[model samples]
Target chain A: EPEVTQTPSHQVTQMGQEVILRCVPISNHLYFYWYRQILGQKVEFLVSFYNNEISEKSEIFDDQFSVERPDGSNFTLKIRSTKLEDSAMYFCASSIMMGDPYFGPGTRLTVT
Target chain B: SQQGEEDPQALSIQEGENATMNCSYKTSINNLQWYRQNSGRGLVHLILIRSNEREKHSGRLRVTLDTSKKSSSLLITASRAADTASYFCATDNGSGYSTLTFGKGTMLLVSP
Candidate 1:
């Protein structure tokens, strides 16, 4: 089965540095999303994208966070300046329809 | 608000036993989904039960939703050690490409 794929399975960056997490969602799926799990915490929603714009976002997706579909196949999440609290397992998901999403093997971001 | 909360935070059972996880949500939802994540890995979609549907099944997984009570349950039958993972329940409002709200998840350990 086709699945979402993410690059850089693990990322380590300095606290004040900028980092970008990349994802290639299923080719035919239209809706894409970003979610994060902070160690043992719940998986929290960051943002969702469709029709080339952000459809919905959570409070945690603040000014420092942004998402882009730079090209047809790549969805990227950029953190302007990373914080220690930003360290988490970031997952990318996609779906052809609403409600049901297929997730990728997450990228573990470690901000030190 | 914590939209989804799962009970029995951790469970351990031998192979061939059945495992059931329960989830309750705070608000109305259009659909509920179950996902499994191995230690430090990405989420794998297990099943989705819509608000209009009471029960759904796929392979060894069974899911049921009670809209009136805003609760759902996931049952894995005759599970194997490979089924050991953290199980989470997520919900969406059925809006356009809505964001998913996830629970803290139940850690299931299927011992051989």
Candidate 2:
């Protein structure tokens, strides 16, 4: 079974630094998404991408966050400046269609 | 804002027992999906039930969706200690968008 894969399984960064979390979605998938979970909290939607553009985003996906599919397989989430609250497990997901989404193993971001 | 909320935040059951968790969503959805997460790990997709479908089963996992009630339930039969993990319910609002809003999740502790 083909699965979504993310790079830098864990990252530690300074509070004001930038961090880029990368994901390689399934080759044939047309839609991609990013979600985050604070420790002990529910998973929160960040953004969704299709046709190399952002299709939807949540309120939490504010000025600091941006997503890019720089290449055919790579989908990345960039945080311009990390805050302590940005520390969480960030997940990348993909789907052939909208109904069933497959998730990656996630990248744990730790900002201090 | 979260679209789904799961009931019984935590459950404790003995190995071999059946475990059930409920989820309620605020709006109409295209499909509802179940995922499991082990301690500090990535989410593993379990099953998905579409709005027009009432039930679906995969291996030891069973999921039922009640569109009229905007709710869903997940049942794990003959659960083992390996099943001890946090289970989440996610909803796709039929927008043709790939984003999934997840519930707070139910932590199940299957003791041996």
**How good is the docking of model 2, by CAPRI class?**
high
For model 2, residues A1-112, the per-residue Cα lDDT tens digits are 8999999999999999999999999999999999999999999999999988999999999999999999788999999999999999999999987768789999999999
Model 1 per-residue lDDT tens digits across residues A1-112:
8999998999999999999999999999999999999999999999999999999998999999999999899999999999999999999999887868899999999999
Q: For model 1, what is the C-alpha lDDT against the true structure?
A: 0.93
**lDDT values, one for every candidate:** 0.93, 0.93
| Model 2: residues with Cα > 4 Å off, grouped in runs | none
Which parts of model 1 are misplaced by more than 4 Å? Answer: none
* Candidate 1, B24-62: lDDT as tens digits: 999888889999999999998888888899999999999
Q: lDDT at A65 for candidate 1?
A: 99
- Write down the TM-score for model 2: 0.97
Q: Which pairs clash in model 1?
A: none
> Model 2 Cα displacement at A19 (Å)?
0.7
